[model samples]
Target: MNPARRTTITSAAVLAVTGGLLTTTAAPASAATTCTSPVFKRQFFANTTFSGTPKKTDCDTTIDQNWGTSAPTSGLPSNNFGVRWSVTRDFGSGGPFSLAVSGLDGIRVYVDGVRKIDLWKNTSTTVSKTVNVTIPSGSHALRVDYVNWTGSAKVKFAYTPRTSATVDTVKPLVPTGTSVSYDAATGKAKLTWSKNKEMDLAGYRVYRRLKGTSFGSTPLTTTTGTSYTDTPPPTGETYYYEIRAYDKADNVSGGTADQGVTTVDRTGPAAPTGLSAHGDLDGMVLGWDAVSGAVGYEVFEKDAATGSYTLLKSLTGTSYLHYVGHNETLHTYVVRSLDALGNPGPYSAPVTSDGIDRTAPPAPFDLAVSTDSGDVRVNWKTPEEHTRDELDNYGRFTVYRSVGSTLGADAERLDCDYSTTLDSANDVYSFGCVDPTWAYATTYTYAVTFTDWQGNESAPSETVTVTTADGLPPAPVTGLTATPRADGVLLRWNASTDADIDHYWAARGVRQADGSFKATDPCTRSTTDPLTALCIGIPDGETAAYAVYAVDKWGNASEWTIVDATELTITPGEPIGADSGALWGGGGWTMPGQGGNVQWHCEGAVCADVTEYRVSRWNTETQTYDLLGTVAPKDGVYYQSYTDATMPLGSISYYRVVGVLSDGTETVAAHPWQIRPDLV
Candidate 1:
C-alpha cells in the first residue's frame, strides 16, 4: 500500500458546522484548532445488528430514493439472486467513517451512482462490506447489491463517522493551561493538556514524536483528563508533544503544532546521611540513608593515600558493598543524590576509616632478664608499629611460662608494672615481678609482652632463670630423648639429681623445618617415681624431639634439657629367596629415626630396600674372607631377614653388614650372623 498521505484536513464548511472558532485555554492562540463535531453521533459499526447485507428502510435514511431492484434473468434461478438496502443520514468527507451493508453471496456498493467498492462473489462468502470511502461535499446516492446461488439472502447496513486525523497542523484543541515538566533523576516527563473546548468534546488524544520527526497521527491518550505523565524516559533526550480534541462522534480536530521541549531536571535528590564503611574479608561495605524521592544513590570511593575517587557503584538501594580487594590499601567513601528523573546531585561530605587488622602480631623477640632474687624482671621489643597510635598506650601485657617448649596448662596475667616509654626511647619495654616461690637452683623459661588495640603485640621477651629452690633438680635433666615405638614415639629423659626433686617432667614436640616446634600438649606430666618418663602417644612418621625439666609442688621449674634422639639401631633378619615364595617380612626400619613409626612406607606395598650380602670363610690356622654378591634395595622386603647362599661349603663363614638410609645415612656393622654350608 502507498505510504498513507500525511494530510491536514481543515475546512470552513466543517468549522461552520461547529458554529464558532475554538481556542486553547493555556497555549498560545496560534496553537489551537477551530473545528468540532456533535456529541451524540451514532457509530454504525459499533452496532452489532448491522451486517454486510442490503436491508430496506432501516434506521435513519440519508438517501431520498428507494433502493433500486435487480432485474432477474430467465435462465438464472431465483435462489441465485440476493439484495440488501439500508440508509444513513450522517455522512461526510475526511473520515474513518462506518458504512454497514446487508446482502448474501455477492454484494456491491455505489455512492451517487458511482461504483465505490466491489465485494460481490457467487460463493458462500459474506456479502456485507464496510468501506472507508471519501465523499464529496454534498448528499449523494448510496446503493448495494446482494446475490446468492443456493442459500438464504439478507441485507443490513449503517453508517457512523469516525474521528478525522489530527497531526502536523494548527494546534489541536488541548486542555487549557497545559504545561510540561520533567524529573531529572527518574527521567520522567509530565504533560498537562487543556480540557475540552466544546461541551460536546468527549476527551483529548495526546500525541508525541521525537524531535525533528513528523507528528504521529495515533494519540497516546483517550482519557478526559487534563494532565498526563511519561515515566522513565531515556536519559539526555528531547520529546515533542501535541494534543487533539475529539467529539463524541469520534471526529478529532487537527493536532496542535509540535511543542518542542528539552527537559532540564532541576530538582536534586536529598543528601545521603549516616554514611558508614566497614571492612570485611571480601572488601568494604558502604551504607547510608536513602534520600527521599531519589531513584538511587551513586557511591564514590577514594584512595586514602592519593585522595583520588572513582565511581564505585550506582546502586538502586541505600546501601552498597564495595570490595577494595587488598587489605593493605586504605579507602574513603562518599555518596551522591539522584532525583526521580535520574539527575545526580552533589556528593555529600566523605567519611574516612581504616580497615581493622584481626591478625595477631609476630611472636615477642629478644627475651632477657634484668633482675634476680627479689624480683624476676623481663624485657622485650615489638615489631614496628603498623598503626599511628602511640606505643605507650598499648593494652596491658600478659606473660606465659612453661617447663619446656610445651607451655603450662594455664597462662598467668602478670601484674608486674611495665612502661612503654622504653619503646619511645629505644623500642624496648621491661616487666618485672617478684617470685619468692621459685625453688633455689631451679631454672625457668619465661615469655612476656603486651598487645595494642589493633592486636599488634610486642615480641616476646624470654629469659631462662635458675631458681633459688633448695637442692635444684640436676641441671634440669639435659639430653632428653624421643624414639619411635609401635605406632607412636616414646619420649625419654635423663635422670635428674635434685635431692628434693620428687619427679621429672618430659615434653615432646614435632620439629618443623622452620625450626619452630609445635608442642604435642601444653600440660607437663610427672615422670614415674624415681625413673625417667616415657611418652608413647606421639603420632607416627613425624620428626619429634624431647625436653626434660624438674618441677616441685611449689610451682617452681628447672631449666629445660632438650635432645634429638631420631636415630635407631637394629639387626637385619635373613632375606628369603624371591623364588622361595616367601614374602619378605620386615621392610625398612619402621622407626627411621629415634622418633615416630612409619606405616606402609614401602614404595609399592611389596617392594623394600635391597642391599649387598657378604659371605666369609675361615681357615683353621688363619682367618680369611671372600666377597659375596650384592642386592638392590628394591629387590627385597624392607627390613626382613636375608640368608647368604654364596658361602663356601665345609668352611666356617661369617658376614658383615652395611646399610644406607633414603637420605644416604650409612651404617656399617656385622649383621645376619655367620653361616656355613655344613651347618646350613
Candidate 2:
C-alpha cells in the first residue's frame, strides 16, 4: 500500500465528479458568510457489505485527513474493509457548496440522501472524486462512504462554499436578554445581549432608530463582541436599538427585542464673572474669575458700530493677552465660558480700554476739480478700504478753496458733507462735492482732506484750479403749446428771456392720475432749434403729455412748461375690413405660443383718417376687448398684417381692430368670426 495515496485529493480531483452518478457545484461567499467545517460521525465496517460495523466509531471535525495503507482496526481485516462518514451542518442561506472525496477505492458522497459523487471500484492506485452540490438554507446532512477490497485503503472528504444557491431552511438561533445603559451627559448608550450558541455563529448586526421610527434596513455596525456603544442621537430623542445574529453561511436570526435609551444635554458653564480691564503699558489686560464647569474661556473683541464681536482667543487660564501694537488704540472686549461639550455661556459685561485715538488718515488721492458755467465741482478717489479710526470708525471728507494750489492759513473751507456714510454713486468710495454758488468767469483752486471722528485730519490732497463760466440759468420759456397731429404732438414754445439762453430740454410722458405724469422716451428732440420739440405718438392709441425746459449756456435748466395731451386730442375712425387666420396649418388659427397671423384692410376714408390700427381679443368671460398689440396703420386700402403669439390654445375669442385719431379717440373696426385655436 502506498502511504502517499492519500494525496490523491488534489485540487483538480476535489472538483471532478468520480462518476456520472453525481453533479458538482459550489456556492460563493456572501456579505455575511465564511468557510466553516462541522463535526462528522464515522462508523468503521468489518466488510464492504457484511452489514455490521464490528470496529471503531468516532466523531471528527472533517473527513479531509485520510489514512493510507492503514488497517481499519486492530481486530478487523485491513482489506475488504470500509468506513462511512456522515455529518449535518447548518447553512445560513440557500446556496451551492463543493463536495469532494479522495480514496484508494470505492468512495461515495451524498447530500440529503442525494448522491453527488461516486467512485465505486477497485483501483491499483488512489483516485479522487469531486462534485458540486446545492442545499437549501438551514440544516442539511452530508455523508461520505468508503470501501476497500484492494491493496490500498484511504479516504478523505471535505466541502467548500460556492456562488450558487441552495435551500437553507434553518435560521440562526436568536440572541436574547438584551438591555441598554445610557449616559445622558455623553449622549451615548451601551447595548448588551446574550451571545448566540450556534456552531456557525459569525457575529451580530446592530440597528438603531428613534423610539417611534422604523428600523433601517442596513445594520449600524457588525461586531463579534457581545456588547456595543452608540452616541449622538438627535439630542433629545429617545432611540430604540435591536440586534440580529448571523451564521457563517449568512443565516440571520430574527431581530432581538428593541431597547430604548434617551439622550440629554449637559448644561453649559455659567458666564465668566468679575470681568475687569485695565491699561498695561501701551496695551490692555483683561481679568475674569473662574467659572464652574468651564473647560475654557473665550475672549471677544468689539470691532464695529453694529456691536458685532469677533472671538479673539480661547484660554485655559482667567486672563486675556491683548495687543495694542497691532493698530490698536482703543477697544472693547467681553469674556464667556465654554463647557466640555463646547456650549458657550452668555457673555460678561463689556469693558473699554483707556486710550484716545490721534492717528491721522492718509491723504485722499486722484483729486479732480472742474468748472462748468457758474459752478465748481471737486471729486476724488479714496482708499479702496477705509482704515479704522482710533475708535474704529471711518471719517468723511472736506473741501478747501484757495488762491493757489498750495493751501494758506487763510484758505476758505467749503461746506461739504462731513460724514463718511456711503454715497449712492460712490462705487469705489470716491467723494464728490459741488460748489454751485461759485461765480462764472472767476477762477479758484480747490483741495480736499479727510477728517476723523476724533478730529484728526489727513494731509491736503492734490489741488486743482478751475475757471467757472459766464452766467446763471436762463428764464423759463413761456407760451408753450402742443398741437395734436396725425403723427405726433407738435410742441412750440417762446424763446427764453436770457440772451445767453441755450436750447430747451423736451420730454414726453404718459398721463397719470392726480394730474401727474409717467414720463416716457417716445418724444424725439428737435435738432433744428430749442423753440420746438416733437412728442412722438404710438400706434397703440396711447396719448402722451409734453413739457419743455429752458436751458442756459451754463447748463442751468428752468422749470418745465407742461401741457397735457388731452389739450390737443384726436379721434380716429373705425377700420373697414378686419380678419384673423392661422398662419401655419392654414386655417390661420394657431394655439397660443404657436404662430398665428392677422390681416385687415384700411378701407374707405378711414384709410387716411386713421392714425393707427390696434388688434384686440374680445374676452369671452368679461365681454371686453383686450388690446393685443399695434399694427402698421398706413394711408392705403391694402391689407395690414399683425401676429397673435399669445392666443389661447383651446379658447374661443373674437378679434377686431380700431383706428386711432390725433385726439386720442378710437373707432372700432368690423368684428371678425369667432375662432378657436388648438394644438390637437
Which parts of model 2 are misplaced by more than 4 Å?
1-37, 164-188, 192-205, 214-219, 224-226, 232-236, 244-257, 264-680
Model 1 residue 669 distance off true place after TM-score fit, in angstroms: 99
lDDT of each: 0.48, 0.64
Can you give the TM-score per candidate against the true fold? 0.23, 0.30
**lDDT (tens digit, per residue) of candidate 1 on 128-244:** 556676554334556654455555444455544444434211222434456777765445678776554343356778888777777766776667887778753463457887877
Candidate achieving the largest TM-score: 2
Locate the minimum summed-lDDT window of 10 residues in model 1: 590-599
TM-score of predicted structure 1: 0.23
In model 1, which regions exceed 4 Å deviation?
Answer: 1-153, 158-183, 186-242, 245-262, 266-268, 292-318, 322-332, 338-344, 349-680
TM-score result, candidate 2: 0.30
